[model samples]
Target chain A: MTSLRHRIQAAAVAAALAIGALTACSGGGGGSANGPIEYWLWDSAQQPGYQKCADAFQQQNPGLKIHISQYGWDAYWSKLTAGFIADTAPDVFTDHLSKFAQYVDLKVLRPLDDLGPTSDISDGDYQQGLAELWKGQDGKRYGAPKDWDTIAIFYNNAALKAAGVDPSELQNLNWNPTDGGTFEKLVAHLTIDTKGRRGDEAGFDKAHVKTHGLASEGSGGGGWGQTQWSAFAGSAGWQATDKNPWGSRFNLDKPELQNTLSWYFGLVRKGYMPSYEEIGGANAVGTDKQIQSGTAALGLSGSWMISTFTKLTDAAGKKLDIGLAPTPIGPSGKRASMFNGLADSVTTLSKQPENAAKWVKFLSGAECQNIIGQSGVVFPARPAGTDLAIAYNKNERKLDVTPFTQQVKDKTTFLFPVTTNAADIAALMAPRFDAVYIGSSPISSLNKLNNQLNDLFKVAQ
Target chain B: MATATPTQQQASRRKAPTGYRDDTRLALLFILPALIGFAVFMIWPTLRGIYLSFTKFNLLTPPKFNGLDNYIRMVQDPVFWNALKVTLYYVVLNIGLQTVLALVIAVMMQRLTQKTWLRGIVLTPYLVSNVVAAMVFLWILDYQLGIGNTILAGLGLDRLPFLSSDTWVIPTIALINVWRHVGYTALLIFAGLQLIPETVYEAGKIDGASEVRMFRSITIPLLRPILSLVLIITVVGSFQVFDTVAIATRGGPVDSSRVLQFYIYDVAFGRFQFGYASAMSVALLAVLVVITFVQYRLTRAESSDLA
Candidate 1:
């Protein structure tokens, strides 16, 4: 019995030693001096364009290397935050307007105001309000504006023609909080039941929709559905906050916002849009996929998705006839879109902060922006780059994306809310919005949630 | 040529201190690497985490001592309470379903002890990565285009909202957890069954005892230790479920499925409230400790009674 006990203890000791060796093998030390400057981004579609810029930058500056990594949106943030905790964060990364505020507050970002290349960039080089959005509460810039995106309506021309509606009618669509105006009527007209009847007809089946008028993930302006209903809500005079970048008070409880949400989700009940259950599942089809398959006539999307929508084809290998139109005008007598931009930020923990800043400047400069514009993946922040992107889309993809540009030119764009507690605010409001989309709660429920969100803001302050 | 008595041998053993020293040194050499690693990776981190629970840390800045503020806030936080409730519900649902199902399978496998390949087939789900299994289940349970709803539609029944509705999301996630873990759990119980000597059962049979009666009186009492182990592990694992919830529902439909671990993750990484998250983690550890102690005592009392 004593010998048996000794054997068991030996076996356990062996197992523990093995686990220790494995753990020792897995962990790595901090960044080295000669290591490549690590860059991280979320959008896979824009990777190739940035890779081109990285290659050019390396050729120009010898002995310097850049390694770019891309991940999907949700995993990107989780991994990036974990990297920060482990002190293995990328030297430079693409920053979002919604997320940079927290990074600035955490003091993880290197201020760009004193950087040589960033200081060389003139205010007029970027589009209006693009450069200012990267500044923190200390009035120091933390990022270099790379590109901007605006919301627009992506329509399937074939589906529009099949519904007997003129394609031009979509261009002039207008909306109001009460009746939804002509835009809602157009949506009802585009909707078709399984029995081949339009949604406007009395005999239409709401349960069996063959083609939905609008393709949405059903969060209705909640959880970064900026392109989905923000345009409608913005045009209805519902700002996310009274002032962005540091707005302590959220404007979600405004009656105009409530009315907009009620009318927007009412489309789901009317069978003109997909229900939250249908389109909000983990494996639910994306908006672009629905448009390509003729399941949805129109998808409210950002200019960043233009290339993805254009490349979609039908089952017969025929190209999907995609058209871009400006968002519908709301009751405030003007169209509006959330003018959001992404910027490249250098981390303060970078071993080579100067090199990282140099990479960011090159990536955000007009030279690289123009190259990115030619790829037609997104509208570059520079005006000249935007012009090049519009021409490239027209000439190469045969798709016109001027409607997105028009939002910027006509001054119908609103800044995305830039609060320090953006994630907490979203956490408080997302479920409430989900309740609204699921028809389990009224739109007025947001008033209560808004109060809760404001309480969070108060705590944050 | 007479052999030494037991006491004489023990006295000689104690006198040879060199032999004892050699054995002690060998044992220390075997365990020193592991001890060093545990101190570095486990003990240090645990101590640091406990310290962080009393501070304010945002990962980028140095942690500042915040006294009991994080604990006070956690007590008042509605989301933390919601997460705790959801986690408890998940624990009950998953542990209740999985333990019963695993025991049944283990008993059946014991009857068919010759079929060793069945064990491998059953364990395949446990071998699969949790994230991969979650993604596969997400595809299968998709509300519109999933095989689950497709089959329901084909059977002339209304489609169930497996991943979307607040009412069904947690239960569905619990079912997925059961599917992935039941096989391994059954294997552990089967191993425990193998350890129970057959002679006792044979004696019961000779006494004209029925199989059901023998199983009830003998098998159950003998399986208590393994059953306790499985229950405690399942309870602890169910409380910390994050990957499946994250990949499937993202605690959606109004945070109905937001378990404690996922809430801690959202607070730590998403909101950058590391200190608060650490406090929540400490609270979770306390809850697990209490639960495990109760289980240990209950199982010990039952086994002692049987002995």
Candidate 2:
């Protein structure tokens, strides 16, 4: 029995060794003979549009194939970083412009200068500031313009009407760099819960109030970063970086940013927005959820959310009536929106660089931008694409997409500062943002965070 | 007859060789593979880590020797100090709670003369994966629509921020550790209980000693060896409580849940500072080794007294 036990153990060890060897040897690149190039994207919502693009591309080139995969934005970066470390990143991948500088620094992407017919897609056709965001520090293009999103105020028309406020009268509320404009009035006018208490009323208990006037799901970081607090930085005309024209050095400790976060969180404290405790779940209650449920009369989000929130109905099975407008002005008279744009990039490790470049160029082309515009997810990076999106939203979806186009054209759109260490700096700031939101840290502490960020970036240099 | 007698004498001489020599050869053959595995996997890796801890290696490019620069920076890093304080707090809280609960359960099991199946039921949770356990706990602690908070609200009390608050995060993580390991530690002590001779208990009872007295005098002393073993295991496990904190909080609410391992993960994977992360890991290993050695000496002295 003892000898048999020994034999069994030996056999098990041999089997494990064999399996490990096989896996180590076989699990790598170099499979299939010139098959489809792998393309990775983060948005499941955009998968159908990408599929459409793929079908068109495949028809154009028979031997060329496109293998597309999707991941949530958070997991996408982790996987991308791991793939880069392993020398096995996807041949073609999608990335946000704020994230471009870090990867460019790492030299993980191939410059587009070597790709064919680069002059065919003029930079002027796309949003100029956004198109310029993807240029590496070396002044070489690393991404082709895909789509752009800018922050906006999304309000429930039904809630406004019931509260006796004419939503139209509140259009283009103005403020200077010193005083917060009609933001305070609009929030009060639109806010009425089932108990019929206004936020401005004396008896209103901010802590116990059942419904809020507005709420925002703050996700901080480069790619997943949103305009919860950054908009205030833009309104104050703060820049996060200066090397690249689009690079941002978030003046996080600046009076403008502090004032913005303080007021934002104050809304929660004053019963104008949902409490951090109230909205806590596996996934936080977002602007979309707030507006769709009529729990919040107003929400701060972007145009892409219009498609998502427009489809959501209330518990009573009533469809929500939503409208989009520019973000409220800070003390500065300038209305501001945090601008974000995305670009398609080809990996330096791609087996088929030519095929990958063609796909990227095609996506950035006028024809594809027109299709994206019609789908109404985002304003096409191209000017012609924006017109198509507006027409499509008006004719097909029957909603006003013109507000987005108008906002961008009016120059309220502000781009985030890009830096070589933007990703690291954003990671550093995310926790601080949460602290400010929870009332755990003082608003002035943002300066300390900013100083630390400069120190980290200086060390990297 | 003379030739046959000579051949038989030669055979007897060959067969009479000592069995100890053959036994030693067999033992060496059986242990050689394990020895080789230990050298390659543990000793070599440990030495390499010690060397690499002094260098700056990001895994993308070749490593550069930076002398003690990484270590010097670590000394000044506030986050590192914070992580260390948090880790020590976690270890103390987790081990104290787990050891007490495990001892109680173990004594209860030893006292039981019926229902052997109860042991299986008690041990079931220990077999569950940390991921599944963390997910269950996460759902329970979720601020909205979670059962724990809902129950609190139903009882007319304000809901506690089980995970969202900075103060409660570490305690909640420690609770998870206690829940997962209490049963397994109990079983280890129970095994120690079984090893106590029936004669010793009979002798105590014969002298008209009470049940509690017998436990205090005989059972407690006999169980020290195994208890020390369990203590060491729990301490080491608590020191490296990474998975629960990772799955539960990802070191959020302003890094309240940040422990040494989580800090290392953030530096290595999150920010791509692999060299700094390696230095942190090397420091953690050194701390663990010193604690383990001290434990060995203490337990050895106590066990010698038992003998």
lDDT top scorer:
1
Residue pairs with backbone atoms closer than 3 Å in model 1 (clashes): none
lDDT of 2 by residue, B1-307 (tens): 7799989997887787689568879999999998787556445555665666777866566778999998999999888998999999989988988888888888888886546888877788899899789879887987655799989989988777787677888898899878988889888888988888888989999999998999899888888777777776667667777878877777766767788888887777667666677788777876776676687577762452345
DockQ of 2: 0.20
lDDT of 1 at B246: 87
Candidate 1, residues B1-307, lDDT tens digits: the string is: 3555877887887888567888989999999998897667655555667788899987667889999999999999888999999999998999999998998889888865668798788888999999999889888888667898889989999778887888899999999999999999999889978888888889999999987898799888888877876676667667778889989888886778888888887777778777888888778867776676687677762352234
In terms of docking quality, model 1 is acceptable
lDDT of 2 at A431: 73
What ranges in model 2 sit over 4 Å off? A1-33, A117-121, A174-180, A188-196, A219-225, A242-250, A281-283, A291-295, A316-318, B1-25, B113-117, B205-215, B301-307
lDDT of 2 by residue, A1-461 (tens): 32223232332222222112222332223213376777888878778887888888889878888888887876787777777766657778998765777777677788887778453556787886877777787878888889888877778888788778777765666433333457766775566644777877767666555557776675343232364656665666655554445344446666766666666677766677776556652136678777775667877777767678777788888777777766666566676776778889988778778778888888898878887877777788898888887887788667876556666788877675666776677667777777777787888987888888778756776
User: Candidate 1, which segments miss by more than 4 Å at Cα?
Assistant: A1-32, A220-224, A282-284, B1-31, B207-210, B301-307
